[model samples]
Target: MTDQSAPDERGAPRLTTREAAELLGVKPETVYAYVSRGQLSSARAAGGRGSTFDADEVRALARRSGRRDTSPAGSDLAFRTGITLIEGDRCFFRGVDATELARRYSYEEVAEWLWTGELRPGARFTAAAGTLAAARRTVGALPAHSGSTDRLRVAVTAAAATDPLRFDLSPEAVLSSARSLIPTLVGALPTLGDPEEAGGGSLARELWSRLTAEPADAPSLAVLNAALALLIDHDLAASTLAARVAASARAHPYAVVSAGLGVLEGPLHGAASGLAHRMLREAVDRGSAVPVVADHLRTGRRVPGLGHRLYRGEDPRATALFALLEDVPQAAGALAAAREVVGTTARHAPLHANIDLALAVLSVSRGMPADAGETVFAVSRTAGWIAHALEEYGERPLRIRPSGQYTGPRPPQPLPGLRTTP
Candidate 1:
């Protein structure tokens, strides 16, 4: 913690390590553990405060921890990232709490910060008229029932074709491309609601109307916006890695985003939310989580959205989403069902809900189609992929190549002859 020796920027009353432990009836070491779990927030030392926690938050976490235990996360990736940190149950973007960042900024603001490491308050992204028209024209050629990701892939390609400077990979050039392409990706989609609503103030508001015909309420719209911000980046996720590899080979920014999009729908990658959406819908349909969860276990199928490889406790994104979701009247049943799913599954393991489940809850509550979570993921992850591309662009060309440890037949085996007609 930095020794600012000043009041916390948030102005919350702070507690020192010993004071917090005494209040929580735990050791100072356990106090640090609480920060790691993200159950508590800490601030730099100031006014002889040393490192401290918000008094009210620590009290709340103390009450909660008395009821259930959270396990510390186990494994971590070796890849270095200045963009995000997945520590224990929490995520941080350049050391700022991502959940908190989402609560405070628009998705466009978050994406801008990720790309340039500078906060631009009230930043807005707008696509050029020609590019939007071209992208929409290309996407219009697809079947009416085309999936969101498919439409997006086509839209990106068309946008690329229209950009005369796509080959100019300078940082300024790439940032300009991203600022246009992101909005274009949204604008290209056929609006399912009022065109005026889809033509909006914040990117999240614009995206909401494209996603569903339902009217956008302030509370629910806030949730959507926060989801987008929270998902701006993860440390070297599969799709981000793919984007970096492409960038390392000098691909243009649009192509880097396309490469990321290509890897997003795989089962082991970004498709978990779709599965979770389906499962949540079933549970909501049956009006109970019991049978749905039991059936998965009985069939030997893992319950979707229950746990995450990246976290051993709760997903902080889910925790934040659930907090915001509490204010949305339409989300009550879906949120309850999500909690039930977690409660039902936790009897057997330390499994806890992840961001996929949070997104599933959002989609299910908003009356979006089953794959809507995937759509949200793809759009949000575009920012992350581009961030990775920017980082890779600064590294040595093709620097990610790794030699294979062959476990196949010995290398000295004689080469087989070319086969004649068999």
Candidate 2:
């Protein structure tokens, strides 16, 4: 082995085979074995004669090998992300409190922050005319009964197919595509009024027209903006993970968003708001919240939008959005219904209102479609999915694959006729 203490031209320390072996408490040959088994990486020596291993990789491998536990059940595959964090009842986006961000910033500003880690107050969010036109045509082709989220999926797929630059995986290109994609997605959905009336403006104003025929009022617009900001990012959520998995395979940003949407359509994720909306509608129709809550509980089913897996207290996003709806005349009935349901649950369980509850209330109060909340969730979460995809693009590909533990029947011996001859 060459000099063990030598540094590469970049001034980083690299260990020789023997030195790495010694540090790992193994023979030099064993060090080569580790490299062969993909446990370590090596580079050529300064003289270009011998191989030198990365000191950090060797040390990490040594530590991993020295651990006694090898069971997969006790270990987990986790991807580190700098996007968002949920601690207790609080949520943060890159160390900034999300509630505060929601209160102070528009959804566009917040989404820009999440994607680029910088707040550009003057940035514009607009899609190409051609892309928007294509998306609208695609949305129009879908069945009239299609949900907002289904239209969104169709739009994204169409957008991906139309954009020749989508395959560009660079951070700058991906972010630009995302900025355009979001607006096009909101614009493509069937609106309740003349499309021209929903002219260029904030995302909330644009989305408001799609969800309702009512004019854009300040209180309702603020609630919509806050909802978008608060929902922008949540660390490694199922949909976000799906986006990251596609990103890990080097899929385009539109395709990454598509992957996330596929997962978000599940009842347990984005569609939770639809169920909550139904619950609130039942309460409104029954003229009593207690009965609805009790009936839902009696059925051995969870109260949709009542509890969150990550929050021990109330969900902060729920609190923030609900606060915005407190005094609106349209929201009064829904607010009362939510209070009754919450009060009833408080007596027996520690369940608290989550973001889905707030979203459901927003939909009911504004007289939006039952699936409007899910649409908001899907659109807002697209920003997060893009952020995660950007992060995953910088990582080594195929790193998210997880090993599975087999717990089924043992492998059977091949039948005489089925066996292949050597």
Candidate 2 per-residue lDDT over residues 1-422, each given as its tens digit: 46445786778888988788788777776666555535577887666777888887777666555622232322213435778877657999988999999999999999999988999995668988999999999999998889999999999988887899999999989998999999999989988965776887898889998988777789989999999999888887889888988998899999999999999999999999999999998898788899998998899888888988788888999999889998577898998898888989899899999999998888888888888888999999999999999988987777666557779877795565766789
Return the TM-score for each candidate structure. 0.80, 0.81
Query: Runs in model 2 with CA error above 4 Å?
Result: 1-76, 194-196, 408-412, 415-422
Per-residue C-alpha lDDT of model 1 across residues 134-205, encoded as one tens digit per residue:
999999999988989999999999999999999998899999999999999999888887788987589999
The C-alpha stretches of model 1 lying farther than 4 A from their native spots are 1-79, 407-422
Whole-model lDDT, model 1:
0.84
Model 1 residue 46 CA deviation (Å) reads 35
Pull out the clashing pairs in model 2. none
Give Cα-based local distance difference scores for all models.
0.84, 0.85
Which candidate number maximizes lDDT? 2
Lowest summed lDDT window (length 10), candidate 1: 69-78
- Each candidate: RMSD: 10.8, 7.6
Which candidate number would show the highest TM-score if scored against the true structure?
Answer: 2
| Location of the lowest summed lDDT over 10 successive residues in candidate 2 | 67-76
